[model samples]
Target: MRTSTFLMSIIVLVAIMCKNVVNGAIAEGGWMTYCQDKTKAPEGALFACFRSNDGGIHYNGRDLTSSVIYSNPSKANEIAVVLQGHGASAKFWTNDHTVQVYVKDGSSVNYSIKPRQGEGRVNSSVYSSSDADVVIGK
Candidate 1:
């Protein structure tokens, strides 16, 4: 009976997990795939962006549209990205950018950028997209 209960519990847990993943609960924000190498960028480098009509200048890419245009989405309705070097740096487009790429040392973690804090690159500065950061995994 104990073994049966344990197996049933495990099955239930797995079912719930699967349900969440399929229903987008586990992926509440959104899923996006970005290629570092433009040469390898899937044909047009298309993606998505999103926005909030009620908010003030809150827009994030909701979907991919065309070449040189990656319409990336975010978990929050107004997910704004600011690629420092990619943009003019003079100002950040509250509803215009997708994701910002920053440069730092080689001591950063995979998912978190805490250890590499206060560290800067010899050529540029470190940037991130809130918690949705993408670092070069070496």
Candidate 2:
């Protein structure tokens, strides 16, 4: 159907544009950068629960381990983000079943409800535990 095709194209275009803004070609360990986990994610990863928002990458344990944004989760307080940047936390609080992201200028975007029961490819570092294994060692 022409209408279906058109809608698909529009969604694709939006995704592309958002990626350009979020990616910004920032690599591993770069501040304000984005990285994707396009495969099986580790259990207990914050990003594992954040695959719905645009240009959003789960801040990996590796990155957090280095404390690029802070000396440690308990040390230097590093939190420069908008609503869009905290979609995961918002989801936990609102229970609206949608992910919302806020940009530096206060622009916000919302993604549809994920249903919390879908199987999609995510970065291997997304979860702290999947089903049987511990992603981050203790």
Candidate 3:
């Protein structure tokens, strides 16, 4: 009986730890920053940065009606952009190192980060449509 109780306790503890790990992997609690240069953006362009709870940063943008999602991992100095059209959804894993962007109806842009560069320093050329031009910088 004592062995069984100990085994159950161990199982419960493991379950609790696994739950916490899974919860922490989800993105939560982030901030937003507008694009530095708005003049070049297309009509109704909106871009901002969101800081996740896991120390990663998400850069989301929209122009004319299309949207883009970009992320910077917490442990690396690289940037990844995932572009999707309106009503489309995407998922970015924390361990991803490849750069990806998807655009269906409108347009999209690619971003690159210098090695060892901090989040405050980024270089990217973004566009959502034919008339949209978004330049992101410090």
Candidate 4:
């Protein structure tokens, strides 16, 4: 009886996890896949961005569009990405807010909900590396 109870508990936990993954609980805010090589971006780039809408989730090169076009202007070899809540920056953010990309040249780019389109706005800036860590947030 104890073994049966433990097995039932494990099954329940697995079911909940599977449901969350399928329902975008893992993607509640948004997610991005970066180009391993920034020099060849948006070209043969295995990239995807997501934004949740009332209608449903919109993906880059699909339904949602990015106003901030990513070009490796500095010719950096790799790009650093920060999901809205996953960064070590001090920024005010809500769920489903923004994604931030950083390059080594003290430059940063932010992607957030379009104005009046969803829930937040993109505020991007540049500062000395000592003063602030590279960050992207809504």
Global local distance difference test of model 4: 0.33
- Candidate 4 lDDT by residue in tens digits, 83-124: 222222222222344333332222333333333336555544
TM-scores of all models? 0.20, 0.24, 0.25, 0.21
Q: Could you give me the TM-score of model 2 versus the true structure? A: 0.24
Score residue 26 of candidate 3 by CA lDDT.
27
Note the clash tally of each candidate. Answer: 18, 17, 3, 0
How well is each residue in 89-134 modelled by candidate 3, as lDDT tens digits? Answer: 3333222221223343443444343323333443344434332322
Best by TM-score: 3
Error of 3 at 40 (Å): 28
| Model 2 bad stretches (over 4 Å) | 25-138
Candidate 1 local lDDT, 2-102, one digit each (tens)? 99999999999999997864443112222343322223223322222223233223323432111122233433433322221222211112232222322
Residue 23 lDDT in candidate 4: 41
TM-score of 1: 0.20
C-alpha positional error of residue 119 in candidate 3 after TM-score superposition, expressed in Å: 33
Better of 1 and 3 by TM-score: 3
Best by lDDT: 3
Worst 10 residues of 1 by lDDT: 83-92
Q: Which regions of candidate 4 deviate over 4 angstroms?
A: 1-94, 104-117, 133-138
Q: Ranking by lDDT, best first?
A: 3, 4, 1, 2
